[model samples]
Target: MRTRPRGDAGQAFPIYIMMVAGLLFLALAFFAVGKASALRNDSQGAADAAALAAAQKARANFGLGFLNSLRANALDAFLIAPFAPPCAEAQRLANANEADTNSCTPTSGYLRDLITVAVEGRDPVDSPVLPGSEDKVAKAKATALIEFRCPNPKVIDADSNGYPEAFIFTCLSGDVVTIATADIERPGLWESVSRTLFDVRLVDQ
Candidate 1:
């Protein structure tokens, strides 16, 4: 109070600087978190899109009655390859690393090489609502696996479900329909980027 202002002025300056510095640090931390979140979302979206595209291709080829096994494998390979370049680019921007081959090994919970497609055929059967009338029905299931290395090596068995599943249906009127049922769960700070697509194709019998 008594002639203390002159001496305390310089001391106050340091306190002001410290406050400013703390604020700056907090701002930077928040910015970093936001940027990381955005990147994670982008990577996840890309993965889902790619998986769906590949599944559709597999369905189309199967409907045409093409080489089932080859088509399945080819479609998976084709779909996954395209994603590599884009995924790599995304990883770079996000400062993330690409998945290693060994990461997808059979022993690992992540998917490895082959894509699985399960086809189920249902013929027209008597509808419960329409006693005399018959209804057309068919169903197909397809699944694809994209393996990636986990950021935290300590984390094992990231996915308990094993693989994502897609369901497809076709009505007698040659109407194709598809539905996808895949749920993504994250543990700690890590999350799975899974893509699912439902596609249906009708053939002229």
Candidate 2:
């Protein structure tokens, strides 16, 4: 007959069970951290998209007013013009990314415009390690800038007041765009011209 099983082996079985339980808890905790990180990243991406969309919309809206200013021989007025609020665009983009826009603010200066947007993620952390993680959401903010690419205009013609009646702009891409005050009234002209004259980019808030 075999000798009785050792009592030492029986005692070690409980220790093994405890070790496995501890390890499982640690794994779940790590997984929870990773899920939280992913949620934050998604929130940041949504904020960036919302801010950029707002800035771009503001830049496009500037086209009509800018064209009108040029026609009036008041380009300087357009340079310091106020931007149309683009909060609606920001909201649309945030929703598309599964987030909500908490705030959208636009500020404009001489030839420069900036839009800042804050967003909250729709999904929660939802981690097993934290009791209330399912109710915890992520938030982030981003800013975007839209500025005139060419500050100086190469004057093709000047009126008595030294204002440009016709001008050539050397854009950042080294493309020359010529505009005459007389031809600015053509339909859909500003749409193409505005894209070339302005540049949009993300910026530190």
For 1-205, candidate 2 gives per-residue lDDT tens digits of 8887799899999999999999999999999999889999999999999998988898888877877776666778888867676899999999999999988887878878888999999999888879998899999999999989876777766767876678788887898898887777787777778778988889997
Query: What global local distance difference test value does model 1 have?
Result: 0.33
On residues 13-35, what C-alpha lDDT tens digit does candidate 1 reach at each position? 99999999999878866665564
TM-score leader: 2
- Models, CA RMSD each: 25.8, 2.3
lDDT of 1 at 5: 60
- Quickly count the clashes in candidate 2: 0
lDDT of 2: 0.86
